[model samples]
Target: MSEPILSLEAVETDIAQYHILKGVSLSVPRGQVTMLLGRNGVGKTTTMRTIMGLLRNKAGQIRFDGAEISGELASSRCRAGIGFVPEDMGIFSALTVEENMILAAVSGAPDRARLDWLFTVFPPLKTFWKAPAGTLSGGQKQMLSIARAMIEDRKLYLIDEPTKGLAPAIVSTMVGALRELKRQGASILMVEQNFAVARALGDHCVVMDDGRATWSGAMADLATDHALQERLMGLSMEAG
Candidate 1:
């Protein structure tokens, strides 16, 4: 395989007195989704935060496009073309959808073409263009969060649970939008709990256990091996 666009080698992180990431290592190949999966509180979000420079890695290296970014600031990381959509959605609730998106476009005013495409991927953002973000439904808010990150192109996206607590139909829509993002050649490292979502969107997969990446392989392999799924993810994916 070609060299990964982003790679973490023995990356470790700490929060106060807790060691969240204990030598986590993984790679996100260019233009593919690498699902970061684990049961709750296994440091999956920590891994994402560490990569985005929200939390500094105390040891090891984080390389993005062949440059070490371990010690970089979060704003520097953002400037370097890494977009992040945190689990909280990170939108300004009081602001209109348009206002939220405008702020996310760091370089300048939002790109018209990109906004148009995102509107197709998520139509509600356009429907509620002038509506306060807080007035949107849960799914719409999630879409707006993703749309903001995607308002401007980025080398990679770090997304956390784009579909958590949504109806099945909304999850399906989220999956479709993400698939479109993949089609547009976006490299993404995502943390998702919904096994179906992970299985559907992941090309490559990494399983984290107790603050470390314990397994890494094709998502297909993990999906088919029920025993492995049970062992790593602690639950087999039940068909719907």
Candidate 2:
């Protein structure tokens, strides 16, 4: 296997008095989607935040593109080619969709070619170009969040629980957009609760429990192993 583009080695993080991530370690290979899976309260989001520098790690090292970024500020990391889509979608409620996308662009305006492609990927973004982001439906907000991250070229994307609470049809649209992202060679480390979406987009998998990785392998392996899924995730594929 090739070297990972992003790596976390024994990363430890705490929130106030609570220890959320304990010795978390994982790798995101170049040009592939690596799914981070876990039940609620299992530190999956914490791990993503640590990578983004939203939460500082109390211990261990974070390496991106072969350099240590453990102490880098979130802005610095973002400038160095890391994009983040937080769990809450992070769109400016008061801003128009066009304004949000414009702000996300590094050059103060989105590149026409890329913006056109993004519109193709999520058509509603084009339809609601002038609408306030707060007025968009939940699924549309999620699409806007992802579209914002794609406004610029990035080495990796750290997305948290993108499919949460979406209707099945909307989830399917999200799955299609993500699949297109993969084809376009975007490296992603995503925390997703929806197994079907995970299985569709994940090239590799990391299963977390109680703030640590309990299993790691190809998504294909995890997808077929109902027994292993039950052991690591506390539910079978059928139940998922």
Task: Give TM per candidate.
Answer: 0.97, 0.98
Clash totals, every prediction = 0, 0
Clashes by residue pair, model 2? none
Off by over 4 Å in 1: none
User: Over the stretch 42-124, how does candidate 1's per-residue lDDT look in tens digits?
Assistant: 99999999999989999999999899999899999999999999999999999999999999998999989889989898888
lDDT of 2 by residue, 129-238 (tens): 99999999999999999999989989999989989999998898888988988998999999998888888899999999999988899999999999998889889767
lDDT of each: 0.92, 0.92
Candidate 2 residue runs with Cα over 4 Å from true position: none
lDDT of the structure predicted as candidate 1: 0.92
